[model samples]
Target: MTKPPKTAQTAGGETHQSAEDLGVDALTTNHGVPISDNQNSLKSGTRGPTLLEDFVLREKIFHFDHERIPERIVHARGSGAHGVFEATDDISDLSKAAVFTKGEKTEVFVRFSTVAGGAGSVDTPRDVRGFAVKFYTREGNWDLVGNNIPVFFIQDALKFPDLVHAVKMEADRGYPQAGSAHDTFWDWASLMPETTHMLMWAMSDRTLPRSFRTMEGFGVHTFKLVNAAGKASFVKFHWKPRLGLQSTIWDEALKLQAADNDYHRRDLFEAIDTGDYPQWDLGIQVFDEAFANAQPYDVLDATKLIPEDDVPVRLIGTLTLNRNVDNFFAETEQVAFLPSNIPPGIDFSNDPLLQGRLFSYLDTQNSRLGTTNFHQIPINAPRCPFGNFQRDGKMQTKVPKGRANYEPNSLADHGEDGGPRESPAIGFSTVNAATGTDESGDKLRVRSESFSDHYSQARLFYRSQTEAEQAHIASSFVFELSKVGLLEQVPGRMVSNLLNVDEDLAKRVAAGLNIPLPMKAPAAKEPIDMEPSDALSIHKNMKATLEGRAVGVLITDGTDADELAAIVEKVRKAKGKAVIVAPKVGGAKLSDGTQQKADGQLAGTPSQIFDAVGIILSEDGCAAMLKEGAAVEFVMNAFGHLKAIGANDAAQPLLDKAGVVPDDGVTGLDSKFVKAAAQRFYAREPSVRTLA
Candidate 1:
């Protein structure tokens, strides 16, 4: 009998067996040999070259050399967490998927990523966000891979490579990494009319999301849901944040890169770690084949969207991310998402982009993961018991018990164990409609005429935005196109494409770029002014509440403790966070002679990271801060970014120096300041900066 290891309590107050007490068997080399000393390699002297005969050193170095798997080609920079998906409404009539059964709670892992840039890139780039969720259900693993935007740049899958190549860093210069605001992207986008609709969204405030928790996600392609009776219906998936839509202004987004490179990633990690779990309601727009046929735009077109007003979204589930990953590399990096990983109740549509993705994801995973058994990786593995005749691939983890690795084996007759068999009754089946076509014809390389109406939805999106949002869109276009120095004609061509979307938008962009307006590009189909959907506008749909938002309070030595405490308490009561930003991390000494700690230092954490800002200072503190450039810029930037500001009487001189005028958003520290901090003052934009 082995002696039990001695138990000890960790710093986190959890009891665990002491590693040293576990004995020699606990620490071992790859070959099962016990390691005596792992801290140092075998060297001739204390600071000499390592000996080549040291097997432990050799093994450790060799393993470290191959430790990293290839990063994802698209969504390389990502963050993940563990969570549960709870089905709140019964959708058995639409799909027989166990994950969709009422009251069923399926364990899930979710990864959010930026579409462009390498693993080392900053999080605040203007790029599409990948929202991929892997659900470990009773049946099998199901991956819902989607984007924050509802539509895509191209309708056909073959054009995906070209689109990515254009948006990525230039091959020769390798410059403008992690952003599309460059020559190559605008040059390619101006030439491709199919990209106009998506370009509109890319340049909008949607690309500058304040945080991942506040962003909305959509399945870019239409999918099919199959019932137990073999009935299929067209479906589109959506994830709406409970906190509502919120986006940073263009200037604020730029400042955020300088403020904190991992702003979004840190925000998500801290939110979950603090037990303030982020949640999204899963909704689906389900319609029959008849509804698809009646739509003016083709259902298979990836650039088009079914308006929420046309087909109301039916809320079916809620996904809450309550736990953070224990290991970033093993879980966040190794996890793979396949669009084709559908369960028995789900099927595919003829959406060409989706069809191409189904094949692309699996192939990419194989090449990147360097194994056909990538699914065996714990993060990507199925939770349910799974057995198959497929055996012996690279990195195979399971060992089949018997010699009968093939189907229809008779090893059981000899009293030997037989492998598991398939169940056709519960197995996944493709929808019958997948083989049928509305207009049957031979396969061809040409695009369908129904997919050519590229400008209508672009126009619809632009016209639907509020005046302030439209101005932001126009300014973004100007900023991106202005960077196209290599192609002198690119801006004009892009402006021409914009003409089809909105004439005023094109004219504004042209004026901002100092270029003459060009004629509208020839549309394959004429544009139509579709009715504006209020849901398409962020400002119109945003919840004017401070819940889940952060407020930064700038303080210094001799600050008024009572005023600072009161504001912080009010923010907490509103379900908002109060971050103290002081001149030093050691924080300020209040008038009461007590030293306080700060959440951030003045120079590192800027006002851009917070929803609103409050300045609480004593006469001496205010005088000291007025001399510091960071303090002036903090208040000035907050006002310029259209954020609410709260100030104490002692901070009046600092506000004057920062050029802040009396506005509804700029309030004294009182009950009114709390209410004002809940929302932005968009009307104050003109006084701050010029718009396109």
Candidate 2:
């Protein structure tokens, strides 16, 4: 009999048992070679670069990469655009990368996507949004790949496969696409306390973005910027939207899925097509080793974040997507982003998740694009000069001019000037000073002790939110957990984990599900109360402006032309889009006997997609609108969604029919409507919906 390996408890009190002890098949390579340590890759030391010889990782990731044919395993559903990154501030003190040179303009491609979904999934799902930018720098292509949320669910890269697998559609049923509110996700999350922080973000309004242009983007991992003096400063990248932060209500997000499958994609395309370029100010938080050492949590831990209050973000550049994709398949689909594609001055951190990503993304591109020559694709190719001696892989597109395939040869005499000889001064170099704790030591597969305080930031995020936002989070929890059927213990187990975040939050979720409160999950490190960051709250940081917003104008037959024109003018002047909605796709006859052309039809364009609504109906038009279900919903949904509604006196009957309550956001068709349309009425949420 094979003797079973021993089981030990982690600091979190979760018992990790061996395969034999768990009565499960041993995890092995594709060739059936036994994997002794599947949880961590082989490295020179615990906090060191992953060794190239880790076949377990290679096999697992290699297989995972090709799981879907011609589609990404994650971030498959994407919307991309051509852009230019303009360096607005001089950051020569920070890095030598020419992309950071003042007044320098770098062509860029930005891909925004949702994780845990297929290419066929709807755009408006409650999931982490990928924000990856490929900067065609003078040095090289710099791929600053990240997400909308600042923090990730797990610390180590080894757990990435598991985390993604759990959140993906369950294998047996292959259902619940593009969403985390399912049995497999909760069951896995209930056991892993590290997921708590990101779960908070995923459940929040952050996931339900109003537009791709409005959401914030984060690097999620600490990186290094090497100055001309070889001075290294740890940096976190941020993309602050020019339009400001905006999000939809949970109900509004769901309705948007039904209203338009490609809501975000279409919005992005139309905005760019109409010369409304989406812009984001590139910001960076620069810190030193001393400041990093002083933090309560490790900066290398991907699950944690350094609040903007602690280290304020410095705006350095602007990212503007001014052009839509010419071809979706050739440009958007084939564009590959590799974490390894860093410019000379930019370098990696010892972030475990980042380390794994550095290794996996290149392989992913190869698998998806079906060749080693993926860089030959115009979208992924760098605009800067590039050459190498090595050549001829599958689908080799470039032609090498000379016989200089190998390095360290006197091949210049053989009609070639030794193709792309190494230039140490001009090329990329690594800062070799000690950074991570125990940079080199024994080859042990271990989780960092510094990464154990999982619940502290989670608690901080919850406490930071406003009361209304808190209720949305709690309600989101209830809605997600209620989907965890058959796994009866999972909901309670997840609630226990939530108890560690906040007892009130746990109780609210428990009450929402009609379940008794469970004891708090054991802490790996006792969670300490951290200071609440106003920057973390979407509502607190939201900009109250109509710019980049879309206002739907509901007009019917015999609608007041003067009122319609006034409302449209106000919206345009405020830099907001005015989309005319009517009973028919064609023009609607107005009071002035002029035909009012509509941007969308009543049944097709639901109120959920718009920021605010305006109803300009005559008495007969109101009667006609009241009889139509779409018109009634157009008003009801706007009210239910907490959007500003401006209606003419004739539209009062339709408003009353839709159960519209009078609030600050509910105003007559006047100047107040434009002001009110600029923001959402959060106070009215409680009356409109039953939140946890």
Candidate 3:
């Protein structure tokens, strides 16, 4: 009487249950017989190609062949990982979403992707990243599908397909894969005045983020959260990088594409493998309906952004990616996400872009998943229990055992119920709202006058950038526009558009293009004047930590062992990585008679791939390195890129050979330069000669 375990009870409420007592048998074939040969498909001949006649073979191969659905038109190239999201703080009052209530630990899957690339495209492309997350909660799965940038190109979802078409490679030529600096994009962007603000972002360093971990994520459209009390609050979701914001120079980004196409992927995998898990703080720009109505622009406009100064961000939780996926196809590729897949407490707004997204995601999945029951895929399946009366679709796995299939059946009266009862009181309920309608219904398909002022935020963004960043932006514009070999078709149109943002920027771009500047900018609602938000500047927000950063260590035949060891130890202590490059790929002999293996040969590893570099040599080794053009260029390129250079007394002649001068970031005996090396050298870039 004192000793019956919970497992001792049977379905009949008897106290004599055992593992061998009663239950369904193990999994079996489709006919409910048994499955023993799942590993091997039956074939007439052992070494022959797969047989088509066998139903088991056909079933497995058909599924495997159709396993790969079409990749997304945008964000085709992606990498993902599995992790756990532990809620550090409680915001139950604001949102009843179980993932963020109290100290709940939710399992999460995150996919990071490039916007304009194919499945086989390079990882370091200059493009916006899709930062989408799936959280498994007790209620259901909550998908926060978002992008790295906060603002979008168009204000309405109606324009999304056209925007994507323009940016994609031209249908006829089929060239310029994963690029936007082509004629079609420029033409469409010049015609669409609303695209002006986002064009600035696309041209800026944000598009050339150094890594996925260092960038921020945003739920580009506004959303709503309903608390337990049924009160709704307007919310804009944000994912702020714990490492702060950082980006690579355009030149460095181009070089990296050739040197290491898998740069970001390798960095992510290694970081997790080394226990340096990437982390981002979850923040929200929460507001009330009153604030949305008081805004100058339409809150539903996807092209607009709520300034951080106007509405402060609330830090509620942190998302740490602590694990990597075991298999890419099983986990990342099969993972399906839709913005419409929200939990009970979370809801969507009337944002046009979001509304369109809700439909587009499902439509795209049909082609990608190849079936209506795509949710049955393990990666996309809900962990919580689910039941429905609907059945008999392609690849149906469940079998309902009952005589009655519909609800409210007479079979239930005979104790043979065939359906589950509905819970209307505890189910999802849409909040009813009424617009000021006169007769027919709520009017649609019209933009409010408040959405017309496009230049104010654009100007604020420009003014907010630091002097170095502003110059980079201007230089980037000049570089991209100059690629438009036809002056009248693209460059002139772009200059005319820039005039609306800033007269001086327009003038400089015109001069660079050798075109006459427009006399005046197109008229705007009010003279664009807004307080500069410091949060908009990436360089200003960048942190001093060198975590996940790399350093190049150059060695020669007579490299000093003590010096190399000390430098490598210091880099490791600062959470930075160091790779040893020797004059030869085989090995390098040290002064202490010790030979160290080279991580890379001088010809293989260029200094452009590292955050900083250090050089050690003997007189003979210096002379040899000077004679080798690759070695000379290694030091020279690092200097030109404004990377911090560390050297010993013997390495002076090599520096002289490379024509490197001792700047503030250059270190000799002291290691103080390590600190400066973490910061990018914006001053030196303008002076460097452009590639001919």
Candidate 2 residue-wise lDDT, 456-489, digit = tens: 9999999999998999999999999999989999
Q: What 10-residue stretch in candidate 2 is worst by lDDT?
A: 432-441
Clashing pairs in 3: none
lDDT of each: 0.91, 0.91, 0.80
Model 1 deviation from native, Cα RMSD in Å? 4.7
The sequence of per-residue lDDT tens digits that candidate 1 reaches over residues 332-417 is 99999999998899888989999899999999999999999999999999999998888998988888777988989988889987
lDDT of 2: 0.91
Off by over 4 Å in 1: 1-26, 39-52, 434-441
Each prediction's total of clashing residue pairs, residues at least 3 apart in sequence or on different chains, is 0, 0, 0
Clashing pairs in 2: none
Alpha carbon deviation, residue 507, candidate 2 (Å)? 0.6
lDDT score, candidate 1: 0.91
Better of 2 and 3 by TM-score: 2
Candidate 3: stretches off by over 4 Å: 1-67, 403-413, 417-426, 432-441, 485-487, 519-524, 689-692
